[model samples]
Target: MSQDPSTEVVARELRGNILLVMINNPPVNALGVAVRCGIVAAIDAADADPAVQAVLIIGTGRNFIAGADIREFGKPPLPPSLPDVCNRIEACSKPVVAAIHGAALGGGLEIALAAHYRLAATDVKLGLPEVQLGLMPGAGGTQRTPRLIGAKAALDLMLSGRHMGAEEAHALGLVDRLGHSNDILADGLAYTQELLATHAPVRRTRDAQALSDRQANRASIEAVRAETGKKSRGLFSPLKIVEAVEAALDKSFDEGLRIERELFLQCLDSAQRAGLIHAFFAEREVLKAPETRNTKPRAIAHVGVVGGGTMGAGIAVAVLDAGLSVTMIERDEAALARGHAHIEKVYNGLIAKGRMTTDAKAANLARFVGSTSYDALAPADIVIEAVFEDMAVKQAVFAELDRVCKPGAVLATNTSYLDIDVIAASISRPADVVGLHFFSPANIMKLLEIVVPAKVSADVVATAFELAKKLHKVPVRAGVCDGFIGNRILAAYRMAADYMMEDGASPYQIDQAVRDFGYPMGPFQVSDLAGGDIGWATRKRKAATRDPRARYVQIADRICERGWFGQKTGRGYYLYPEGARTGTPDPEIEAIIDAERARAGITPRSFTNEEIMRRYMAAMINEGANVVHQRIALRPLDVDVTFLYGYGFPRHRGGPMKYADTLGLPKVLADIREFAKEDPLFWQPSPLLVELVERGANFDSLNKSE
Candidate 1:
């Protein structure tokens, strides 16, 4: 074995006529500067050595190469760039083999494409997922992938940023062969030796004939371009990917590479790239809560879910999907049967969609136990209360759990707005109580707010995070507050929209502006879809404490009072005829709004879409700043992740906090102050926002500090 003198990351050893080059970077073996240089040096050594007839490249750890080293993001350019390294490998006189195991993504997959042949382990995952980070593959990935797999498949892989398993990759011609052994090195050596014995000729992806049919390639490119335009509306990279793939068909191989590199640079320089990179890092950072630092999560095998409503059944399904056994308790046999039916309905839908087989559904259902009695939950490792959103009702559920659950079992609440600290205080095991605020459609939504009360133990918090990972959910640690991070900020921003509606803007106009700003739907649309009665109930609950002097919008209340509780009843701020999913503009709603404005003795004014977004974003950012300052959220990124995963905040803009940073804190504060001039009570600028602007700092700085 010989280590390259320049860098130790790459090592080479001669095995008969084959030279094995191993990348020794730990973890995912991200392609850093040293690794790039080392690979070039090793390739050089193999080409010069007489004993080495073929070179086999493989990583030593779990992954072949996950991607670029994220630590080097936004840093100065390093020597022997990934593009150069890929060209070196492709230019080697000797045949090169890449043995892919685990994840071979982004630049890593690009390097594999540059090799003469590719062998992947059965469990290997391959993709060019740079589009997720607001980048198309820079180092020949765009130029070569289409040549290897054709334009449609390559564009699909890059655009979706989804991992293709080994079988799928082999079928798509992305992988030359699939290994049957557990040891990647052994599989690679055998494959390389077989290639040498056969005297196989060098195969470069650039020289492939996949793009020989120019007309077909153009057709595929245009199809993808149309689809991308519709789906990736505000995104910058997906369209560039289509353009680069088009270049591969229209330009020469070398020229195509040049175009790819140029487009990649453009994507890298885009503000969307900055926002996406921040979101990428923020997701990983949000999981690192102070409580989870040294503390170990408790072992959770059997989960108990209280109630049999939609949220409860969803939680049960999520737990079952995570491979945990669930014991569900309902108040009565009819409700228990409904919960079971709900669980089965999900599997039945999956079955109908061909995503799940009958056997798989049966297997998952076998682990689920449902009963009307609470005694059935005695053996549960954790009991999650998903009852009504009332303190007294939640207290009753916890009191039962405290009496029946096994010692050390985690007690969690799925309350959306109730005070969890009060619920914890009412129970005997206050230390075991933690809030696991799963969003509606709990099994589907990615966000899980792990609300930590004052009395909850660190281990319990850690356990909640662990549970989140098990359920394939993004966990954001939240200090106890009325609505926690996402909902609290949501309430503030939704109020801003309501204020706009009552002042001059129509709900339809505000919703359209919000959608134009990248949210999937506006606050009013969301309220309607979620059933307007839900928010109406919350309003009535807080009505007694509502400030008398503050402006109030009674339009929603009036709509609900007439039994038109949104889509369920087919009427809201918008009309949904015959239970249609999309609502239409309602003349009655307009009349109601005009009457309300007259009742409040306020004159109506028109708002431009841009003007509407300014106030809406100002409200969200100001509340997000306060959330971080009050430690309801540990950092700004936590708030970002919460909204990104939960509230349909556009991933391209990052989250509310990240959007604020990109928009410039001073401008956001200015907007807030300007709005405050009209309604100081509603637009009270967050002190943290004001402080950050005074210091010329941004939310990102606070993220770095935490």
Candidate 2:
């Protein structure tokens, strides 16, 4: 059979009465225009050929189809859209069987739903994850998914944007069968032949009766809408997804598709969509560090973690989870035992949650070795020190690591604010030293700031990135500095929050405003959760170097002085009565604030939530710009990714840098300049922000240049 001249993305070959239609687009087979056209052309050809009685569609490589081509985002729609292609596939006279493997998501799932039958490989992952990109399914996904699976299941998959295993998909009736064989094509061909032999009829998902129970479907739709409303407060696409699913249950298939397309277009035009798409692309872009371009990562089989405090134990757990053998060291045997217990507790919790088997936990722990001796780490490929934040303590730890580690072994310090250069200088081998700043709860947090000191080798940086990938973490290359990227910017913004708190706004009001702006929690809430003492300690450390001209907010220090160190102490800006996870506003804290205001001789004024956020975002963006300008971060997107993954920066608003770009550089600069009138030293505009505003450029332009 002759291939379509328009595109080569789809190839067709006749296997007896079955015509094999293969998606040849490599690297996840994104359903771009060419692929769409190719599929429609192949379907037409198959229908016209009398020799073809059944059709089997499969992808060439690892994935069947990942999703719509990200490259096509923000571009004008091309002819033979995904919806048209899906409709054509469903309308084909010959029965079509979709054999899915490796990430059949979004448009990929839609295409599968359009087929008469779907056979998924045992390892296949299926989902409609368009809600993550701030868009609902534009094709027939919304309409067909609920018709194939139940309404509740379809909505759950789409809203959560979570992947389901092949068995789950088969159980949900999204897939007809699950293939156990390793060879996908063999299994697919055999399944297709079975269908032909049985004279299977075309079973369009749109014609299915999965959503036949009107009353039940309505209840499920309403239930999902209520849950989504609470969970996705500022998000736009989730509610739209609910609406589309509702349309599927209430309206005809074609009418439901029409509504889906309209809602999809609405989401496409939303600012949230722009921000989310930027976030999606920025994540991939941030992984490309200059050091990783040509340099190969050193093989890391065994890891050593120094110290067994919370941070240390967390890092050890993360390392062990990455399938690396870990040797954890503490100052004494008791501390080592505590660290071992901490690791065991995490696995035990997983077992209790049914997420892990006891056998699996035992097997993972078998690779772990806890010791009090520094000599135990001699066989380690890389040693990460997660001891105290004090410089002298870190220097001593690095000295031990330098002396004990073998040649070319990566010696990493997991310090949040300390200078890696100073730590490297203290060590004998500075070339092998790098800073790996893992956020609190390292095993769960996704961000890993790979802080590169001047003396560290490129291979070491590359190895850090490789390690991050193995740990299922997002790696951002950061130049050595106080707090590196995320925390430094965080300090600036948190200072902004402190300024607002002292100026007029209550901590609760400021927190509420921050929440309204899209963060999962307010700055004060995060401070409480992380323990206010952490920041207080940081403040005390910088006190000697802190500029006297800058306005200092003593409210936190006053609170800490009372031994009210946040959630742990049950009292901070908010009171955590009975160790409640959520805190309530404390009237006594207000009394403290009033006393501080009286002492400072400041007349407090009311501030709106909008005003509060304006200052908060201005501080964050200015510091982010300064980070990019000073080369602490390679690009603006690096800052964006760091905040998005590390900090609780809202993913829907994108990161601080992307938010700045979306909010307009001029507006942010204007806000900074205006705030400068009150606190010039604190509100000083970033030179980079000024330059970008003057040149009519945005942070994204800097990202593109990089």
Candidate 2 to native Cα RMSD, angstroms? 1.1
Residue 605 lDDT in model 1? 97
Q: How accurate is candidate 1 locally (lDDT)?
A: 0.91
- Which lDDT tens digits does candidate 2 get at residues 1-706? 9986777988889998889988988788999999999999989999999998999999989999999998888899898999999999999998999999898899998999999999999988898888888998889989998998888999999998999998788888999998979888999999999988888888888899999998999999999999999999989999999999999998899899999999999999998998899999999998899999989999999999998888898898888888899999999988888888888888899899999998888888999998888999999999999998899999998888888899989999999999999999987889999999999899999999999999999999999999999999999999988899999999999999888787889999999998898888899899898988999999999999999998998999999999888889888878888989899999999999998888998899999998998899999999999999999999999998998998889998888888888889999998998988888999899999999889999899998898
- Model 1 misplaced stretches (Cα beyond 4 Å): none
Model 1, residue 429: distance off in Å is 1.4
Give, for candidate 1, the lowest lDDT window spanning 10 residues: 1-10
Model 1: per-residue Cα lDDT over 270-381, one tens digit each: 9999989989999999989999999999999999999878899999999999999999999998889999999999889989999999999888999999988889999999
- lDDT measured at residue 202 in model 1 versus the true structure, 0 to 100: 86
lDDT of 2 at 473: 95
